[model samples]
Target chain A: MPSPARSALAHIAFSDLVVLLRGIFERHGTSAEVAAVLATNCASAQRDGAHSHGVFRMPGYVSTLASGWVDGRAVPVVEDVASGYVRVDARNGFAQPALAAARGLLLEKARSAGIAVLAIHNSHHFAALWPDVEPFAEEGLIALSVVNSMTCVVPHGARRPLFGTNPIAFAAPCAASAPIVFDMATSAMAHGDVQIAARAGETLPPGMGVDSQGLATQDPNAILNGGALLPFGGHKGSALSMMVELLAAALTGGNFSFEFDWDQHPGAKTPWTGQLIIVIDPRKSGGESFARRAQTLVAHMHEVGLSRMPGERRYREREHSALHGVAIAEQELAQLRAMTGD
Target chain B: MPSPARSALAHIAFSDLVVLLRGIFERHGTSAEVAAVLATNCASAQRDGAHSHGVFRMPGYVSTLASGWVDGRAVPVVEDVASGYVRVDARNGFAQPALAAARGLLLEKARSAGIAVLAIHNSHHFAALWPDVEPFAEEGLIALSVVNSMTCVVPHGARRPLFGTNPIAFAAPCAASAPIVFDMATSAMAHGDVQIAARAGETLPPGMGVDSQGLATQDPNAILNGGALLPFGGHKGSALSMMVELLAAALTGGNFSFEFDWDQHPGAKTPWTGQLIIVIDPRKSGGESFARRAQTLVAHMHEVGLSRMPGERRYREREHSALHGVAIAEQELAQLRAMTGD
Candidate 1:
């Protein structure tokens, strides 16, 4: 049993955590600046209540790097940019740099034209897409970002894993509230969540997963072994996942389902993944005064007693954490300290 | 009870539908030009198997017009355009002409700027987003079109209707197969289908809708009166509905839920009604020749046994209908003839 106040847990300050993460990444061959950026992103995720995407995943990422799956030192290089379109090659680089380069280029294109699409190939996993979309939303733009990972979910009616837990994120700007951002995975549950459930010895949620025999089941172990996560809805979610695969993987020149299998080979040294980021400047796309009207609409929805805007709650959480540092479960804190050899 | 025919029902000449629809619209105060466009759009929807969006919707539309809810004689006019971004004042015109004009202008902008977005305000309902999307798909471009209609569905937990059955359509050019087009409503079932079931005295499918008491129910009558259609998969689907509304309505100067009582005013007369259409040129975006790589990615998915591409089945249906004219249910034919006084 876990205790709320366990002595094994140490409360390392947020800054300390960032420094430790940067140190670890630097030791693993990441450049100093890149390590700092990666550390900041990890910390930000934790602040935003996205603990699943935060530093808790750092150990697995390092293991991937150690296994020679991800190149810690690679950098993103521009492939093309004209009019309102941009193409980027990550050169087997960390996803952060690639995403950064793509966003920068996309902003440039959007500033020049009314809309811009940044297609990126050969990138590694980019953490929670909300961060990538937020900056664009802050600039009064509407943005959609998607990425397709290695296969982990099954199509509707199929037993085998044939698609990634492809996630799509969209952000819209508002004046008073935080930007409305909706980020989601097409699968009923992400593979990482399933692994967590298995480790916890808990039954998976109904309709979330299936067993080796192609029947829906609640056993996480069975799903992790040979079964697959079902899509959110039957065919609609499957169609959405395929759409993401084509847009992110196909359009960006990355491998699709059959070309790369996460099950056959688990860790890194896998083929480079793909991502798509689209930005629409509301000011440019819908006349100069569109953002103001958008703000009014946001206010209207809230006035009607909608609980919260998509990202507003997250933003509120982040604000609270920034004022009073975030709290982690005692067990997770202890694990982090052990991993750091502190 | 309806019977499934071995072969499709007898062909109803498309020209007959076109002429009848045109005559009906003309009698309802639409100009000859706008009526022609509307008829063409309706015919195409039927051809593509989207019978819900085709001539079946004509009766309700006519009633709205007869009640002075829709402005059938108005013409869409340009409100603003800067840096490839455009805003159109539909003047409550028929949706087909207004939306088509926006698409044409956006394509022209894309030709010069590589990407473009067109925001249309005060437009009436547009049927079958596929037809609107396919034109861009045919031009070797990627397109996304979305519309926020009268509030029809509920958000995740809410019993009252708070969101429209917003539909998002994405179209991308493919190599070997037809263009990959996905058009989906955020609700578990489109509201039109509920109406269809109600008219036929059939029970709605489980999870399709909710009764006025906020209980999930299959009774279409309750759903029509005050019940809400649940989002497809609860939170995720609700998030998508919000996404479409923000992008389509907020940015395009449309009314938010609280601003308009759609039940009181079914026709699109409010100045707040709006839509957003985006067109992207793949040739200008992806690296090392996007078209060739798009073909490769699509083939790889097919090779992995996807069974069918996203738009392949729908395109096949359209092809079959073109070879043998579209089928009309006996009751539908009678209703159409009576409405048109033909």
Candidate 2:
């Protein structure tokens, strides 16, 4: 990608960015609270340098709201299906509020039951999964989450897309320092990352995906046009994707990747997906020393020239972005401004 | 790697194999019931053709017992840490009996609470993880298990072994067929498989592991000599290994991979590690329709030329072995008979 046109670049404080995003969603018809939740999440992504899931996603999201593909005024409902289980119905709306509502409940339930699961359905989760699990880890809980999205990846040995990127996130709190966290898509490359590469007119590295004929290719345009992404680590990654499909979609009564022909749609629609979250109270394991033990393991990673833990790079990026402000292209800012008449 | 000396072969009924294993363990010191639990698990692994974890592991196990590295008479104790949580202290014995004791309780707890976790410590887990989770899925529960072993895998980019193979297993129930399951090691190749390749005078494929100085190598001898196994899928698998270390060792109060160097030890001892089991009831998500939905997903996999689900191959192997009888090399039979004086 060429250098950003600096004359059209704008660096806004994190606080200001949040306000801008919140106002844009509000103008598009979401409740103030709902918009705030979505805005805060997106801004955090920007702060963490996850640009694909940050403000860059605004255009498609606003389009979904304006078209009523996602209900702007929806109030997610939660049902306590069992002592330690929660089922969240997002009511065909954005996933943020629904996930937020279950967050506290999950912590509470995990503490009492030792473990808990929250299943969310009929939601559009156009964000990173780390944000959802990271909070639990910060609160002294071990957390894991998986979400299925529009089909973009092919199962191992398959010629066509039959599974979503299906990212899985996990986090464990540490002593004093930030939590150790990882968020990864089951695909060799994430669908969002692929889209970014395609937009930048970049050719993908070899082996990330294949063309429609099932032949491996390095052309991003060919992939975005009619090709399918391959699973990471070949068969091992394929198995992980299969597990995510079962846990999030089949179990939650949400749309499976095969059920959605995302490419066939005339207009972009909300990603109707399911999410599965698991919360575990570390204290229940009789470990007040879990954090320290985890640090011992992490120290070994650092020694190996790995440089950073899974989410450590993101934390550093977030701090730098917070201090310097997040940069957005002037064109992107203008589009948001136009969408909201700001 | 050479063909087994079939002239020294024995065909044993699965039931007789279990009884013979039980008798040997009982003679060593464990009570009849404890031996039965362990023996049954070992036989089942053989029945499923998981030879590495089956009778092939018996020699080392017997050595551990003979050396008193593991307490053959130890009775595992379980405490209900919370409504849905259980902690099992294996008292320096094998993992099978400890897991068996908690199996029924896990199902009941999950039925009522929708999720349950069982943590076993001070145990030696040598059998495949599928047996632990497969029973839960058979009982109409979704199950996942992770166990950390003696460290043999280097975290991605690291030269030293600081993480175990750290296998994770998952199972989901279907309507009428056997449960769908997968058990995978985070390592690019299992240590046992590497040993087999070395014995066969075969070169390992690239990216499987590194030599002692951290240079990538295709020589299995270099890998098994002083080298460390690489995590599967590079960094993604490294992240998965880290998670297992946290969940099974850190959270369960067991030793981390770096904390133990069993490979360097001169004496054979049980892998004094921990196992974490999680069971979830899909019925809590509101319907008995889960099985049909899972079949729908499996159908998609089948159409893609991925003919079998993760566990289907093993299931078929188990069925064939059950009918044909398990084959044991005559020398292997002699070895077992010598150890047991039978």
Candidate 3:
């Protein structure tokens, strides 16, 4: 039986978290390399202070493994590859491996062709995007990625969930600070936040979600029951969401909203959901000056007092966590411990 | 002097309209070739039913020429060229020539590099973006462009105008039909429309603009009295507008909101704004299969009863206009006739 009482909050070293998480993943059948990559991504998220996407997601990922939804031992294979593009069939593999592999392949292609696009299908969810993009930034390339999901959002005025949160992430190399990364969901709010609110039995901020009858509701429970999520910017956000859905689902030949079995497999449905990745080496265009000009642009923006750069705050958070251990809520750690039976 | 306002509507042949506009532009020192390109863009907009950007903008373009803000005889020079990126200095030249040169350069680079980005500064406003992007789409490429202007909009909660009514345009190739084109302003209503409302002594739609106190108001005059236009989708739209500003202004090294002098030079100050263009060759990725998959996606969307494909209605309008000459409002026709002294 699971413990009703929670474990106390503890300062777990980043290395310790990785070891613990990897052990659990390996025991669940993931290959050592794949488990390590997944754990590294989780740790990166925690270090970046993105608590929602960090270890908090592990309980669900492990649950997916137990239910056989995420094939821990599966691998991705190339379906087709061109001078500037590639298509990968994940073979129901863990998304971290698929994403990492695709990113590497795309960077290689981009080096030669100046730009490369990778379409990945049939993979499990990879919780955080920055980890996938930061590497490209380190390599001095711009990276953009998008993913579609099981429908949990309504088009602008519609009453039913017809689209996914559909995230778009962009990372560009900067001069002084870390790469400027912009990661966002097309929806006003994400499903994870709604689930968190529901679990806490709390009301959501108004305008983030709606009830089953299409009325705006603060109650997360009502929002979860056949309710629809709102777009970030009304029609414009809806338009971008639809675009992501096309690139990720339609382009890669993955199942979309209605086609997915949402009830049985809720980490955004399709046993083989798709994602698209793009990388561009700016040196291929304007040489080193591309980076110089990009840096100048950021400096000009800072001159106007825009507060923080796109990814600066998160990078700072990661720096802080490196100096002082990450904070894990007692309840969350307890849940993870119970799930992994560690 | 203006011939007592010719009230009767007249149907001018589309060819004649093009020739007449071209002739006027040539008379203002623009080269015949540049005039032809500019005229073609306006004609296409008229054909596509976008009157706001078509001939309605001609008088303004010519006035910029007359005021010596736009260098009709000047040509764009490539300031920086990279493998897949280019930056052009328009030399205060007309946008048609600058844009044509930039677009051609980008497309040429994209053919080999897979993708290309071009940024232009010191250029006059280009009237329509579709003509600039459609040619690339015909070759199975995707394109995106953005333009920034003088301050005309308020940040989400601010009362004073602090940003431009920036515009974004995107186009993607289609297999069986015209390429999908979408162009929109970040503001709920454009400054031109607001000016028209104020001139007609009419009120604006609710939520369109705000008064001096940052309160929403429909009174166009009040909104124009030290007030400002509101963004389309509150904070999200504001952020997008800011993004556009940064891309078009900062990246292109053009004047920004606080730096613009809209009234003083009319042509010199804010007239030489910035623009960015991107072209992507899809064939470099999925080959013929890409187009086929895109068709399937469009079909699925149409099956879902979405209003229409991105550019379907516009293409239809163009077809209708090609068969039968376009409708020209009497007042507008008279204005054109007077401008040309016909």
DockQ scores of all models, one per candidate: 0.48, 0.71, 0.28
Which pairs of residues clash in candidate 1, taking residues 3 or more apart in a chain or in different chains? Answer: A69-A268, A69-A269, B254-B272, B255-B272
Q: How would you class the docking of model 3?
A: acceptable
- Fnat, 2 decimals, each candidate: 0.44, 0.76, 0.13
Structural similarity to truth (TM-score) of each candidate: 0.91, 0.96, 0.86
Q: Against the true structure, whose TM-score is highest? A: 2
Q: Per-residue lDDT tens digits of candidate 2, residues A1-342?
A: 123324466778999989999999999889987899999999898778787787778887787777666787889999888879999999888788998888778778999999999999888888888998998889888999999887778888666788889999999999879999999999998777777887787788888999888889998878888888999998889999999999998888788866754454344555788899999998888854788878787776777667668888789878887788877788877877787776
* Candidate 1: residue A298 lDDT (0-100): 60
Worst 10 residues of 1 chain B by lDDT: B1-10
TM-score of 3: 0.86
Which digits, one per residue and each the tens of the lDDT, describe model 1 over residues A273-302?
788888887765444365666677565555
TM-score of 2: 0.96
RMSD of 1: 3.4
